[model samples]
Target: MGRETYTGDVAFEVRGHLGMITLNRPKALNALTQLMCESILIQLQDWAEDPTVAQVLIRGAGDRGLCSGGDISSVYRDMLEHQPRDGGGLLPESTPSYAAAMPAEEFFAVEYRMNLTIAEYPKPYIALMDGVVLGGGVGVSAHGSHRVVTERSRVGMPETTIGFSPDVGGTYLLPRSPGNTGLHLGLSGIHLTAADAIFTGLADTFVPSEALEELTQQLTEHPVDEVLPRYAKHPGDSAVEQDAEWIDAAYSAGTVEEILVELEQHSSSYPGAQQAAAALRAKSPTMLKVALEAIRRGAQLSLSGALAQEYTIAIHALRSHDFREGIRAQVIDKDRTPRWNPGQPETVDEDLVAHYFTPVPGKLLSLE
Candidate 1:
């Protein structure tokens, strides 16, 4: 097979029969930008049509992380300029209309399309996930045919922390998780190690972090169907069982507030549960409610239906106050103190949660 190059900030390299797509911005922990997403989609399309490319291997450049999330810092700056300051106030005279247009429905349309493409790609796709895999990273990795995790792999749907419901097929996958693990993780913004990921069905296989290079080499040399048997080893008992007691107790609650209250009440008995509770307590209350609702509703939906449902929620979330404020605190200002809408989970009404999933006129996600 001949090697070819695809140009972008993302490092696209083809060697042997496999094309490796590496998210290359190590300084930002490989946070994905719109350009990176487009570039990847283009490359995947090209490779999908090419006969020589036997498989696709997606990974990150450095050892620090896979990808932290989307480049929300840029999106947040744009949101501040376009939307009203408090109520319905107009943007300042100096604000650029281009910046204000960023949270455009088009972005979500393109991003969700990319995710759906990955999910339905003709060729085998393998994601070598090591280190942080959150938010948009989950979109890229989890959609693959084979998802490889390492001891260093830390996975989560941390969108609620930033006042966003889980997007990019999260509605589909999270609801598929056993028991209420998906609902629990989505609302709590918890991180799971490789072992935890495997137990929870988030990762297809586990490889030692030290063995990643060898695994990559094997993938480059062999077909993906054979790569696992050639180099992969059996994983140990998953870490999901470690938190079984706490997860069952807290996650079984009917509402987000009830879950939090349960966590707070049980924190003294389990240190891990205490940490998880603290993290959930710190996230956006509105996002938590929406995420919980999304998972609950998504559980009853087909894969495509869940994606369509998530499309509505995602578009509405962009126009909501909490999404921008959460991004400002977490990504832009780096203050780590989001002034969440409703301020408390208990204050968020069920109607507001339902509003997120309500369809917008002519805004349906076209899977075709």
Candidate 2:
């Protein structure tokens, strides 16, 4: 009979039996923060077992979409101000990412945990993913039981552009793609349209951007299982699927370097593969290797296991110069040119990539 009370960037309330969550940061593209993440986690955890709450729905304010990703500006600032006593070596590792004292440490730890919660949630979890659903946006919406994408949806995990690997269970999500398309997308950081998202299994159904509000209202009135089917409709043909043959062949190579070599050999015939190869070439060498390894390893592991592995990579990657430089160029400086320290992929050898997998002192991620 009464609406639930909540405060912070994430707005939560109960409309009838529908538990509603609105990402309140329109200007920031609803970029996720620890507070937003924690609020979401708590509400979802409570609603999961509440019989009165029949389902959950999450969306973003403004036209931008569900969420852009984690607060990378804060992460960039932290990296700049962080004076490592060990000289870019590992921090104390009181937690998964940093020493217990570090404020940013809890961000991913909680965020990853929240992602896991959505993945494991028993009740129906619906996400209204629209407009610029990249990085952190993918994490929130991709795991939902009913992932609703719009005609305006533009989704991708473009972390490699900023010298970061895809995290928040990307390792699990990417490898599950039908073919080497996952590897190609992971390495290239290209955005996918609504049709592409459904083809790639990132989203379930397509609902027009204008119709989403009506759908939400319907969810409050009827069961999601009933209301969703009424609105779900086919978007269109996917352009990403056109390149499936090339992606399978190029990304079939075990490593990013091998993939690049394959792309290079075919560059004369397939301009698309050539362009994909060039995009990979422009990304951070260390991150390319890390992203490759993450997906490869994730194929064999559970969702929780993948999150744990990513936690290790994110913390270790903080030591690298590319992360800070990538952020400066893309976020702070607004320049597209990020001068990667090891510009060439060849320079980032296996040993260097191994450092990211090395565990820290504090507790790692666990759904159990």
Tell me the TM-score of each prediction against the true structure. 0.91, 0.94
Candidate of highest lDDT: 2
Worst 10 residues of 2 by lDDT: 84-93
lDDT of 1 at 135: 84
Tens digit per residue, CA lDDT, model 1, 1-368: 53658655698888888898988998998988878887888889999998888899988878887888788887776666667657321222244432344454666666777888898899999998899999888888998999998878889888988888888789888878777677777877788888778777778888787888888888888987777866566767665667777788888998877887888888899876788788888887777877888888888887677788888887676667888888888877889987776887778777787777777666678977
**Which lDDT value does model 1 have at 11?**
82
Which residue window of length 10 is worst by lDDT in model 1? 87-96
154 Cα displacement, candidate 1 (Å): 1.2
